[model samples]
Every structure is written in C-alpha cells, then in structure tokens.
Target: KLKLSLQEKKCSIEQKDRAISDLSMEIQLKLNEMIHIKTSLSGMSSAKTIIEAQLSAALSQITGKDQHITDINKELTDALTSIVDLKAKITTGEDLRKKLHNKVLELKGNIRVFCRVRPLLADEIVKNGDSDSILHLNILSENSIELLKGTANCDTSSMSGLKSRGNGAVEFTYDRVFGPKHTQADVFEEVSQLVQSALDGYNVCVFAYGQTGSGKTYTMEGVPDSLQDAGIIPRTVTHIFTEIERLKEHGWEYQIETSFLEIYNET
Candidate 1:
C-alpha cells in the first residue's frame, strides 16, 4: 500500500510539471505576438510622421510660390503705372514747347511780309513774246527775288544796292517769297501759322498791295465757290473754327468778330 501511494504522488507531480510547462509555452507565444504588434505599430507611426513632414513641406512651398506670384503681379502693375505717367509728361512737354515756340515768334515781330510774283498772263506773253524777259526775274532763294535791269527802264532809287555791281539786278529780300508756280494752297500753308496767331490772342491783319492785276484779289479771294481753289481768307476761317473745336479740351473758349472795310486809294 505504501508503494502504491508513492507511485500515485509521483504521477501527480509529473502531471503538474507537464501543465506548468504548457502554460509557460502559451505565455511565451502570447508575449511574442504582443512584441510583433508593437513593432508593426512603431513602423506605422514612423511612416505617418514621414508623410506629415512631406505634406508640411509641400504646403510651405505652395505658400511661397503664391507670395512670389503676388510680388510679380505688383511689379507689373507698378510698371504700367509708370508708363502712363511718362506718357502724360511727354504730352505736357510737347504742349509747353509749342507754346514757347509761338511766344518766340510773337516776340520777333510776327508782322512778317511775304512777297509773291504774279504769273505772266497769256496776253502779256503774247505782247512780250521774249523768253529772255522771263529770265530778267530770278528767284534767288525762298526769301529773295532779283530783278535784272537788262537795258530796260527800272526804278532803282528805292533799292538798297544789294545786287551785283555789273548785273544791275535789284535784289529784294522779304520774310518769305513765292514763285509764279506756287499754287493757292502753297501760299495758304505759310499764312496758316499767322492766322493761328490771331486765335492765340493777337490782333492780326493781312493786306495785299500791288498793281491792278498783280494777284492781290486772287490771293485774298480765289475762285469764290471752289473748295480746292479757296483763298487765305476762307482757309483762315476754316482753321480758326477747327482749332476752336480742338482747344475745347484745354478749356479754351473764343468769340470771333467780323469786319469788312474797303480802303481804295487809301480812303
């Protein structure tokens, strides 16, 4: 009976040992599984951190690019403004220069005299029929005329002796001179500036003086109704009205008065 009890105790001891070993293995397996889970979680956290850092860097770059674009836009706007200001200044400078030029012309005795030579009429050409007669008159420059006294009766007492000594040509100088070939339009071009002076607050008068058929009437009043054949008077009227319209932008208002007077024989 003692042997049997000892055997039973040993058996019990072995069974308890087997149970403890099994429980320890199960605990080790659970610990390994927990370790694996922890390692996986740490890796996932590191990946998340890297992704967040990349996202932050990308946002910063976008903000910086946006700011740079804004600065470029501002610079372009400023440049355009400067260009507009420069253009305004240039316009003002041009206007000032024109005003000063007109003032200088006014100070230099704007009452300038221009001489025009009348073309020979068909009747006169038939009467003279001499080509050399045309050569007697010489156009020296745009402002000078020379009348050659070639064995012809010429009134030279009033001349200033500016001619060549042997040629006996009386040289006459005026502010401007027009040749016989000059058209009505050509003459009005020079007279237009003088007409503008009247609009600029100046008393202006243009007169014609010569022999009966010396183109005085033609210069003052061309083919009456024709626009292309209009004279200085009509052209001056047109220009004055046009300038009045143009100067409205500069705050200029004008009143024009008309006067007609005939002073034949200095009456």
Candidate 2:
C-alpha cells in the first residue's frame, strides 16, 4: 500500500511539470508575435517621416517658382508699356517727316512764280469805278489767281496773257500770290526761304518780267523813299549782308556778285 501511494504521487508531479513546459512554449510564441508587430510599427513611422519631409521640400520649391513667375510677369508688363511708347514716338516722327517731304516737293521747281496783283490805278477807278477790277481778276487763294474771260470791261485790255481765255474764268496756280492788300514785307517773308537756298550754295535768280504798265518795275525796284514798299532787290541785298555778318561768328566768309539787265521787245 505505501509503494502504490508513492507511485501515484510521482505520476502527478510529472504531469504537472509537462503542463508547465507547454504553457512556457505558448508564452514564447506570443512574445515573438509582439516583437514582429513592434518592428513593423517602427518601419511605418520611419516611412511617414520621410514622406512628410519630401512633401515639405516640394512645397518650398513651388513657392520659389511662384515668386519667379510673378517677377517675370511684372517685367513683361513693363516691356509692353515701353513698346507702346516707342511706337507712338515713331509714328509722330514719321508724320513730321512726311510733312517735311511734302513741303520739299512743293518747293522744287526751276521756274516757280509769284503773282502780285497791284492796286487799281486812279484813272481806272475814274473810268470804271471798281467794276472792271472785280470782274477781271479774283485772288482765289494765297497761291492761286482767277481771271474772268472776255467782258466789255476794256480797261485791263493791255495786260496780255490775262485775257486769252475766251469764255468762263481761267484759274491759274503759282508758287505764291499776293493781293493788292499785301505789303512788301509780307512778300519778303516767303522769298526769304528762297534766299536761304542761295546761301546753301544754290544758284538763285529773282526777276520780274511782264508787259508795260504791269507793275514789274514797281515790284523789282519799289519806291525808294518808302521803307515799307522796298522791293525784293533791296531787301535781298540787305539780307545777304546781314546773314554774312551773322555767320561770321561761325567762321564763315562770303563774296557777292550783282547784275541788272532790261530787255525790250524780246531783244
């Protein structure tokens, strides 16, 4: 009976030891699983930190690019404004050039003419009383003359080339035209530009040629006593000397030659 009891006690002790070993193995498995889970969580945290850093770097680069774009836009706007101003200035210059070219073209000619209509003679006023004057001649513009054709107004019959047209009025254009109202000074203003051409080394001639009693002498060799009626010849001589004096300050010198001639009956 004592031996059986001792054997039972020994069996019970072995079973309990085996059970404790099994429990220890299960605990070891659970611990390995926990370690694997912890390793995975650590890797995920490292990846999150790398992703956040990459996103931050990308945002910084975008900000710099946006600032650069803004600067370029401002520069482009300024360039456009400058281009507009340049175009406006160029247009103005071109217009001025065109006007100058047209003026030059108008002044170009070998035989330009200036027609000066003298005041009506005292005898003509007595004979016709201002009737023939208005009927015969009309100053159309500063540079145009209109001569009416044949009427019974025979007072202006001697002024040839004025009565050639047989019917309606004939309009004539000239480089310039002066009415009876214009003063000698007024005539000299336009003629002065021509005198300037001569100063620039150009050959120039100013003369008057017309029928008898047509005021040719009056226009060329005006009343010497009247300063206001002084003719082109005297004004030109004085202007030439005056200009010579003015130009002396610029180291210029001049010589002048003068000639006067009269031809009668095509001689």
Off by over 4 Å in 2: 1-107, 130-133, 150-152, 155-167
Please give the CA lDDT of all the candidate structures: 0.81, 0.78
How much is 231 displaced in model 2, in angstroms?
Answer: 0.1
Writing each residue's lDDT as its tens digit, candidate 2 over 137-252 gives 78989889987656455554545555456565678899889998888899888777677667656566777877789888778778988788898878887888897897675456
Score candidate 1 by TM-score against the native: 0.58
Per-residue lDDT, model 1, residue 187, is: 94
Give per-model TM-scores.
Answer: 0.58, 0.54
Predicted model with the maximum lDDT: 1
Error of 1 at 140 (Å): 0.6
Candidate 1 shows a clash count of 0
The model with the greatest TM-score is: 1
- The C-alpha RMSD of each candidate to the native structure, in angstroms, is 11.0, 17.7
Candidate 1 lDDT over residue span 1-267, tens digit each: 999999999999999999999999999999999999999999999999999999999999999999999999999999999988887786687578668867877785677889999777786666555432455678999989887765344334545545565777677889889998889999999888778777766677888888678888789988888998798888888999998997775556898889877567763
